[model samples]
Target: MLLWRFVGRTNVILSNGVNWQRHSRVVKSALNRNVPIEKFASLTKRLFSVMGDGGRLLTFSTTLTEASRFILCLLSGTTALGHDFNTIVDNHSPFVAKYNEVMDSIASPLFLVFPKLETWFPRKHVIRKIDDLVNDFGKLLEDKKQRPGNDMLTYMLEEPEMTDEEFRDNMVVFFIAGHDTTAGAMSSFVYYLSKHPEAQVRARKEVVAALGKDEPNIENLRHMPFLQACIRESLRINTPIVSCLSLMVILSPILRAIIPDLCSNGKSYHIPAKASVIMNICAIHYNETYWPNPYKFDPTRFMNQGDGEEARIDASLWLPFALGPRQCPARNFAMYELRTLASMLLQQWEWNLPADSPHHDSIKNGFSPFALSLPKDMDIIFRRVEQ
Candidate 1:
């Protein structure tokens, strides 16, 4: 719930790019250029190799191809837990199975109408699944700590980390934030790029140029300015998370009487003092006053070297990971995932729109209040690039 709360810190986000430098300093080991990029490149190459001639239908990659929501979840784990456990999550995690079910059963609207349902009364099925994930991973970490392995879990364990309770709490927070947020962002990236083939081509060119007959290295990905811009643009336009919801006020129950009713609205009359209220996040991204041609899909808007009024107008456009002290802690890790996957995908695969793919304007990327946008059920054809 805290992860999803609004901080109204849009203007201050990039303000602390210096602080971003500081905090990002700690996770540099995890984001170590060699391990993450190499693992991701290997994963992407292998996933594509599954699409070889005669098109032998593969299971895991097909699952990834379809359940990208889950793929993003695993990718989050890939970053958080490192490459060691990603395959375990891909093949073995029951939570992965159950999460997809919860998503399939509950569409976004019901939550929008009743955000309280998320806090007070989550679906029993979802709750069980979540509990299962937390408990299972918690135990796994504990076990690994005893074994003292070289992976991230052991690193956290032996490194004089938090108490057991704190570890468990952090895991709960970590898993949810790490998984849900990345899934949300990647879905948007895939969906938007799918819609805009020109941008996709540009991304492909950037990646191929960077990966020229060699594995993607951190240096190459860092230098791919156009691809990074595309990811940033995708994130800007299709901010997977819209806004954090909050009850109008946080008055204690004992002193609640004098509070104005916020929930009275849609009650056919006055709203109650303490009803749940959603912050309008997409409004910030799409604001016409701030953004020129707000409705137009353009990533170049972020990089435009406009002078006079235009550059001033372009300053504040997007933050899908969110803003403020409450902004995502795993942002560095997320960049690793987005850039690495993008680099490898572009380097190895050639994507073409599936037949009958809808136009960008016609496609309706689903939005679940907090989830800014969702990837529609779109099939992308991928063939290995000929050397």
Candidate 2:
């Protein structure tokens, strides 16, 4: 159930700083390629269908997860391996299902503390599932070898340093990295908007006014600053990636005893050399000094920048993707995806959480320490706007 089981140490995410930079360059180049806009539009339309016929009430997270997974699967497949998972049957798609199963199993407390223990007792199933997924990647790699195309797989194959194992590892990394995080972020946005109906109305107004009859292409999306603000606020309030990255946080007694100087700074600070520390993204994002009424969902805090109307805000406090050289490399792509999806959702239909739904008031109470802090549930009604 561990990430290492799925992606070995050779992958970019688990590699050292120098190796990560080298591998990241290739991966980033592939991601930076022009995205398939039309395909995304078609996928969103399909998502609408998956949501409901017209006015049916459904679980919002369920619907969003499906749509998000579908889009990611399609995009990742085509861009990474030159394959198209769009044609696959819904709910029965093996690739998507297998990935979800692995994700769910890995999020368990048992798996987190005792990753190697997955081979014993009931946990062995998780190992088998991951092996199956890796085998699937192997098959895909074989097919790509037979018919190489202009894709990430092709780019990776061209790199003499990349092993077949590493290629398989990167494929899974891309899938996991992009899929649930985006979906969770979108869900959090909608959840907040649902709780704040006035904000939702204002956001919809901004989107409609900015892009009247035009499709939500990248250019038009930029004009809707309110929508962007809402996205950022949602990211700040409920960060999907809570912990930046895994850290060892080592404080060995032997080392401390041997060298008192290494344990503490000359003043008061103390830390063993090479000890790891994880940055709590959610805490920093919610700190009072950085954000007033940190618990409230307010998008206007990000608006009217450089104008005399509001005080200049500090940008360092915001780190939804973490900071430094290893910051989330796909930040731009993630924002683009959120904007496009938000535009389409607001423009096409009116949505709101049902009064009886558990998540009507807030999703804050349901936060769990998973890969992403997803809401327990959100049931919403999506009604088509009469043309």
Candidate 3:
């Protein structure tokens, strides 16, 4: 595989089948650690404090993006490194900058196939920076080996089967995925609800009823069904991972030379075995056959419980996190974070898009293959609600 030359084949991002099992186990085990409600509360307070007094407008596009970056960075550091947010921030790390630059450069099709060309392009500096970042992570892992801490890094290091290269690659993968993707989801949640005032009102009411003047906790979050529905709706509408690559197959020359077969398993048809198929998440989500009035932002689609909803849902049809064993390991974490952040936002403040903001108009146009495409200009205002 092309990625093997850059990042070792043992890395979870490139590994497959049996090879991926051990790495998956380590990641799931580490993430399973109880994340205290205090962490969400702390970040919520920081975000709420930044909004300021009435009429002082804020740009959701930039502001929430920054907030998500900080929150995710802090969470990743603490969860993976066992480092405090203050300690991590105080270190003035270059990881975030390098990560942003590398991700942006990788989004281009040129880099997807010929990543080495990144060495010659305008993003040449970023390619080098990413290598440095990966090396730095490797060194961090080495140091942890000498005196391991009780964190995700140490947990993986403790695993006898995990290699140094695999550890470093997994660290980078988790760092990038844990932050940017979750940020995109959170940003979308805020953006979508801002446009759907009725949904916002219902969500806020659900949140307030669940926790009256109390900080958001996992226990309380579970009971707020409407808020959860809104979250699912946001995820369905603006899936963070818009597309993903499927397996590769080799075929005989005769098979390849022919027009190819319309492969089907008594259900939907698939591409020929020789051709690679990119799972189009947006297309699946908008399939009106499964999702009635698909374009409309309606949370009710996921709400009917006793109506045999679980039995009826086609797992293949809705894949915001992708499907199968390779699906997102941190999905539960992402959902909890979105739920907590949205609950806090709605409970404490009344927010809406600026009258002249063009975000709503440009939302559909933002189609990014890397993650959920953000609105062109996300501008909204928040007014603190009286207790």
Candidate 4:
């Protein structure tokens, strides 16, 4: 009920069967084709501007999080909705505020603990806000109908019988899953880089060699293997989404029939049918068997020594975006965004943790009601690189 109120019943994240297939097909098609490199570059410049022309210390966590959120929102808007919320420049964007409010209400401890309380003591205001947000998306859909473009909404419009409800619901899901997770990822990357200066230097050197004072293009981004490794390592260490949502269940009736009592792999414990299983991503990532010295922040693990190629990562072990058919549709898109932003930041500034930083010893996680890994009190001193 809580999820339905926010993302509706027809979103890709929560929906099942035909609804899931339809949503995933359309969304994956849209995200896969559209990289939006230029958009990422432009928004990155805006972010740099906001960060100031600097050889000074900054509370990077706050600014980076805000910039990442706005950049991702804009990206999602342009690619998904064919609309510009102008959230990057306009900090007080009503739609962004309302969306945040809805998220906050959803993450409320009281409601999370006892969701049934929402039925007893209704959060009418939050529900109304969600409705308004959905209506706003509806307006975007109507606008897109008249002024169609090469975007997700336009593509969905071309579909035989794609409903407005489906469109709006998925848009809400994109807004929810798309931006926050990516922002959290960016934060984790920065946190790791701040702690590991040697890795940061290596990544920056690669970024400079690949993209010398030019914006990151797909061709250039491909050459920066070390930077990509750094991103991968950061994701492994502190994955943005900690665990797959408990709601996402493995409803394999055949498996249930075959192994009626208990199901077990050679390694892990047994699981009964209809069991509520949450794939603990952090545990898998930090497993000593797969990743030797798992706690160390080492990008070299993802690199091939002799060949200038990436090491073959076991997909089963390192699944920050989850695995298999239900993997995040925006995985490639998110990586592109990260690579773009991280490349730009690498080129523009050299950053290290402040001497008095709370995260000097280790990265500290911020409080979040959602299952997101967020860095807190991360102060990095950034020196502007002379062009």
Q: Best candidate per lDDT, number? A: 4
Top model number, TM-score: 4
Query: Root-mean-square deviation of each candidate, in angstroms?
Result: 8.4, 4.8, 4.8, 3.1
Candidate achieving higher TM-score, 2 or 4: 4
lDDT of 1 by residue, 6-48 (tens): 1112111221355434333433333343345565566555445
Tens digit per residue, CA lDDT, model 2, 247-332: 55456555456555533344434446568767788778888876989999988888885651223456668888777767777677
Give per-residue CA lDDT, model 4, range 1-387, as digits (tens): 565777887878888898889888887777766687887798678767766755554434344566567777877777667787788778778888888877777788888888889999998888888788778888887888899997767877777545788888887877776668887788889878988888888888899988887999989999999899999999999999888866523665645455534334534344555677787899889988889999999888999988967888888888889998889888887899889989999998877776788777777777777788877655556667766
User: If ranked by lDDT, best first, what sequence of candidates would result?
Assistant: 4, 2, 3, 1
Off by over 4 Å in 3: 1-8, 52-62, 84-93, 108-124, 142-151, 250-274, 305-312, 362-372
| TM-score of candidate 3 versus the correct structure, residues matched by position | 0.81
For each predicted model, how many residue pairs clash, with residues at least 3 apart or on different chains? Answer: 13, 0, 0, 0
Poorest 10 consecutive residues of model 4 by lDDT? 260-269
The collision pairs in model 4 are: none
Error of 4 at 320 (Å): 1.0
- Better model by TM-score, 2 or 3? 2
Comparing 3 with 4 on TM-score, the higher-scoring candidate is 4
Weakest ten-residue segment in model 1 by summed lDDT = 6-15
Candidate 3, which ten residues in sequence have the lowest lDDT sum? 262-271
